[model samples]
Target: MLKMTKPREDETRTSAKKAGVITLTGQLAKALVQLAGLIAFSHLLTPRDVGLIGMVAVFLLLGELIRDFGLSQAAIQTAELSHGQASNLFWTNALVGLVMSASLFVAAPAVADLYNEPALSSIAPWIAVTFTINALQMQFQVRLARDFRFLTLTLTDVFSQLAGLVLGLIAALLGAAYWALVVQLLVASATLLVLRAGTARWVPGAPRREAGMSALYMFGLHSGLAQLVQYVASNADSFTIGIRWGAAPLGIYNRAFQIFSAPANQLLAPLTNVALPILSRQRHEGRDFYPLLLKAQIAISAALTFVFAVVGSLSEPLVRLALGSAWRESAPLLSILSIGGAAQALSFMAYWAFLASGNARQLFLHSLVTKPILAVAIVLGSVWGLTGVAWGFSLGLVVSWFISLGWLAKCDGMPARVFLSAGLYVLQSGLVTGAVLWLLNSKFGDHAPSVVILSIGFLAGGAIYATLLCLRKSNRTVFRSVLSPVAARVKPLLQRN
Candidate 1:
């Protein structure tokens, strides 16, 4: 038997902090690249062109999620994985990827028919090719994550994003229209696969049946179902809008969502990658992880709330700034969607809890109940057009957040009082920030330059949030802990200067 040395508390903390910083830096770089691409693409492509891609994106995203089949999560969460088991999983994932790719190719015409867009028939199949590549790389990526090789993971992600953005821009310049977006997807997936294979030291051995394989498969089955339901609930609005309102409105709506969700996707998502593996290890060792989890939840909630507040306040200016005046209609949608963004940012922690605790069944059950409610909300909201759908989507998110809290309390033994109190504190902070930003926006009116208004609102809201954080002892400790490393690095630089 191989003996593994358990890292001391300080060592573990230091390693985690380093990994967090690397992941955050990478995500920030990727977000900047994507933001730059969005600005250029918005100008290069018409709303119809963007919308056409959005219409096909639902199918493509579903195919990718289905291809994953939760096996990646299974690999990450499992404490002890043998070479044989890993090899078996690799084969299973590749097979599923091949099937999904072929399935999407065959179903492309039907998807096009549903959207009443013949162009989608060609677009969907090309996008579908990414699945096999993604599948082949799944275990490699998971192993990097499992071993906390975040630097390698971050490098791969950043380079892939940059490469894809460049390719997509070139394709757009060449008048590929919607195909530009397809090129971006294909290039990004291919780049990631190539990089992961090159970087990961481990290669899968020949597949062989191993003991305890059934448990992994079972866990993956539930996890995959939960993922499928969650995706459907989240994307149903886009699906419905594309079918009813066509590509233009869907394009605008999709852009608004992407913009508003930048912080969650870029920042919080990466942190979750760091959090899950650590938490899983802690759980297996019977260590109490609630303190770390709680602090993280509070920090993420506070930060994202502040971000969304600024976004809500400057929605019009931001849309104009980011996408140009041609996409001014996305402004209101962005504002409405910001509400959901805040809700999601906070509630997303519950997912980490569910996965790290090895409670895939509980996660699936929660999704089974909540996803239908969300789907219904989207369907009903569709009757009133894009704005109504945005409203409904936000409402659904808020509801899901509360429901998830209840589940965490009951199923995971999280203290309801403690969790709810922390949530309310963050909610209060967000409201105060949002209100201050709103007042500033109202006072300035639309006459002010966007840059000036945005600068004022951001500074003012940030000051208010910082002041509020200092007023609470717990918040102060959390803030200080987060900032201490940065302060330490800056102090030496300042002294040298």
Candidate 2:
């Protein structure tokens, strides 16, 4: 097994530990900024105004898909990336980004016409310009992630999110209306530029492109395709909802989904980001890699599921209190979207196994097949409006897990039953917590006291679930494995609690 053969010295262990600490710190900081942005944006703008931006956002998201030709993944996943290859990718990305941005600029009128929104004609062009600036910094960001140089990443995010928060608030204060869109994109692009300048150790020059370009492109092609498919599937609901329900309803659904997904995208992503590069480094050598990955998945998934289930069940009161009565409509959508997010959380970790095995095509195929099925579900669900769309979106995630798990089992040489059994504990925990919270909420409805009472009950559910897991033979074994290393430090915290 590719274990840490040479024990990490104090300094090295301290450094590696800092990565996780700083990553969490960064995630928390970014989440706070985003939460602030959401509140500020919602207050300053109407649903119609947000919806108008949402329409432009759908196209911008598509632009982001195109922008992600997977240079970042390729750069990160490659075991032996070089200066020349990095330089070549930087230029290639910049060139494509320029072309895409220009096209988007020209196509602004058509996009506006598609939605019959006249104001979009001017707004679309401005938004497209941000893509050009973003392309310039994409490779640099990838380089940092590849190395798990998250201290640098944390700095970039802290500054970037701060910039966006400041600018977005200014735009709102100025009564910029759609100009808030410009503020967001511009700040993001500028932040990338600042981050690139600060973090990148090497800068690209005119390339004397070599064999590395071929290797990098091959890596990028598969990675990009997989990401493209994944992005499309992820955003399928947005596209479908926009088409069927128009901007206002789509805006409401989008906001609700955003709230449910914020923790996942904002918090859980760093875990995957750290996991991927770490797993890739261990890929060829670890006999224990598969088991380690599974264990990590279980722990992280259980934690996230516990948090979300509690929040989802009690989202009605939280939304009303936090966002006010106008957003009460979002409560149901948040609950449904949270279920989908739980499925997504599992698949995201399982897919890391594929990434670690150097199997981008397998990942690509997994999403390629799944995106269509998801897209169809979105279409079918649109007949019933936003609620149908939310349910359909959740259904797709559940279905995708089964399909991807089969492939994961085959490739990893892990027994499917063992893997399922491990996850079953998590599922059982989530279901029980969800059911208890739901019953409690339904009986009491959404009174203010119910929030505090159910919040404590939710915490109790997690404690009960963890105790149950510790009692189970398989989970006990896994927990023991995890506990052995940190038991000393963790014991005090447990005692104090």
Candidate 3:
């Protein structure tokens, strides 16, 4: 077994706290940039144009996933990795990226043919370039995570997103249409690659057939398979919609899903980035990791529940305000999708647990079994159009959440009851808040402008949720635990000044 140096408990806790703060700030900034870009792009591009890009997104994302081949996860989960092994993995990733890029270029015509969109033929190849850029930076990103260099990671992420948003916006102004979205992705990937290479200390040497490399490769292979299944499962809705319902409706559905999932992707995504490395370290050190995981799930679930509740309650006004009246049809889709956002967010942490515990095979098996069910659900839901699809997708998410928790319990020896108990408070709080907001909206939502009504709903829902959380001792303890670190750092700075 490979052994590694472990940080002191206090230091680890402090680092984790700092990482959380930095990552959350970065994600918030990125979200703002993305939201602004989306608002601008929504006005600049037609629904068909946005939907065209969304159609290609599934393929590009799949290619990106294949490019990584789960090697990044392998690097992070492994306790010890020789420079030779790292170099080998780097080269392997680059090779996969190159091949996938070429494959995407070659497959572009087929994709366009499938969707009967001639423009996609041009769009697919441009998006393929991102795979190469992303592939080259994979190991560097993994190393940054391993070292907990979140500040650097944050800077890279924020700057790249800002750059991409600006470029995309400029392109849209110049009438690039769907190509503007393509430019945004390519620019982001290129910027991230350059920033990562400049900031990361490790440099790849020549690949060597080292002794430990085989295990890493095997781990990555399983992880890659699991990620592939998960990606397909997740994006199947878009794929089916794009093919069956066409671009305009797909665009509306995609945007609604994006709006519905913002809380999970915006908040929990950064948390997961911070959590996995720490959890992996904790597991390696034989530390008790369940409490940390529980706390994280509770906090994320509670926040997601609250946010999604508000969004779901005000789906119509939110959609109209965010995407304009042209996309008003997305309102019901947003509401339906938001129903499972909390469950999906909570289940995301299970991914960390699986990876940290070095259970990629189990992860693969779970995805293998569950993702097909999700795909089927999405297909069945597609029968009802976008709204039906949204409901179906949400149903799948709810089912997947329970299945994921059960798998985590079995694999990690975490009790199912504990997982359920941890999530119960957030679920209840969200339900109550949603009910209150729904009632408020029904009573007086039409009396005011959408902006005013949404503002009132948010404030009222927030107060109710806060009150409910404060009533729970456990929830208060979790809140204080998260806040205490920030307070500690801020107080020192104030005193020094």
Candidate 4:
């Protein structure tokens, strides 16, 4: 048995913060790249062109889900992993990626036929290549993450993504249409595989059978299935919209989704990356994890609340400015999706808990129970078209959030009251900001430029949120807890300047 040495609590705490800062900075850079792409693509490509890539994205996402087959998660969270086990897992990931890539290549024509769009036949094959590229990246990334080498992880993410975006932007300029999007995804994957593998340094000796390999495989199986179910649930709306109403509506919804949810996901990702490995180490060391867990939850809810507040309340101006007036139709969808985003955000930390605790089977069971609610809601929502679907997605997820909290309480003995109070406090503050933005928008929205409208929303809504937090002592504590670390980090950069 190759038992990786556990980190001490104090050292782990310090490293976790450094990891968080590094990863967050990286995600911020990546978000900018995405924002730039969103702006550039909005101008360069037609809505149908964007939506066509989105249509193939379902398969691309499926390829991603299958590539590592949950082994990455299993590997990261394990208390101990043998070198032989690791090598075998790497080979297993490579084989799965190869199989999925070939399968997707064969399925391309059928995918095009399913969409009744001949263009997809070509697009899907290139996207199939990303599956294998990304699969090779998995074990390498897991190794870096296990060692808390987040600086390398972050650099690889940002630089490779920048390269992809540059190439994609060039392709679009040269009239590649939807192919530009495919090129971006492919280049990013290949770049990540190269850079991450180069930095991870460790090499697999051989894929020899080991005693503990079966348990790890089982863990991967369960974790991968759980993630697949959740992915399908979250994306049910896109599939339904694309199939029933075709690409136009799907295009609009996709834009809204990217704007509202993509940034939030990027923000949440660093937290998980930093928190899970630390928490797993804590579990292996038999230390208390709730303190760290609560801090992470507080940070997540506070950040998400502020973001969703601005996006939801100022949906019109945000969509207009980012996507131009052609996409103003997405504003309502963005607003509705904001509610669901918050609901999902609340449950997200619970996910880290499940993973850190190494409860893959339990997590899988929980997902089975909760994830279908969103899928069902999306289906029922299509009865009313896009608007109905948005509401269904939101309301269903809210239901799932409530159920998820209850489940976590049962499983982890989580302090539900504390979590709920913090979430509620954040939610109310968001509501206040929303109200402030609503009055601001109603007064000058029609006459004002989008930039002007957003500027006013930021100042007015930010002041209102700050005031609400200061009104109560408990809320003030929450504010300090979430912001002090951020302030501490920023102060040093200012000093250096």
Highest TM-score against the true fold, candidate: 1
Q: Report the C-alpha lDDT of model 3 over 178-247, residue by residue, as the tens digit.
A: 8899889989989999998998888998977788888898889989999999898899899999888799
What is the full ranking by TM-score, best candidate first? 1, 3, 4, 2
TM-score of 1: 0.96
Q: Each prediction's TM-score against the native?
A: 0.96, 0.90, 0.95, 0.95
Over 141-243, each residue of candidate 2 has an lDDT whose tens digit, in order, gives 7666665567777778777878877987888899987688578868867886877667767577686746667766876788789878877877778877766
Ordering by lDDT: 1, 3, 4, 2
Error of 4 at 243 (Å): 0.6
Span of 10 residues, lowest total lDDT, candidate 2? 1-10
Cα RMSDs of all predictions? 2.0, 3.5, 2.4, 2.3
Span of ten consecutive residues with least summed lDDT in model 4: 5-14
Taking the tens digit of each residue's C-alpha lDDT, what string does model 4 give over 194-218? 9988888788768776888888889
lDDT score for residue 480 of model 2: 71
Judging by TM-score, tell me the better candidate of 2 and 3. Answer: 3
lDDT of 4 at 284: 86
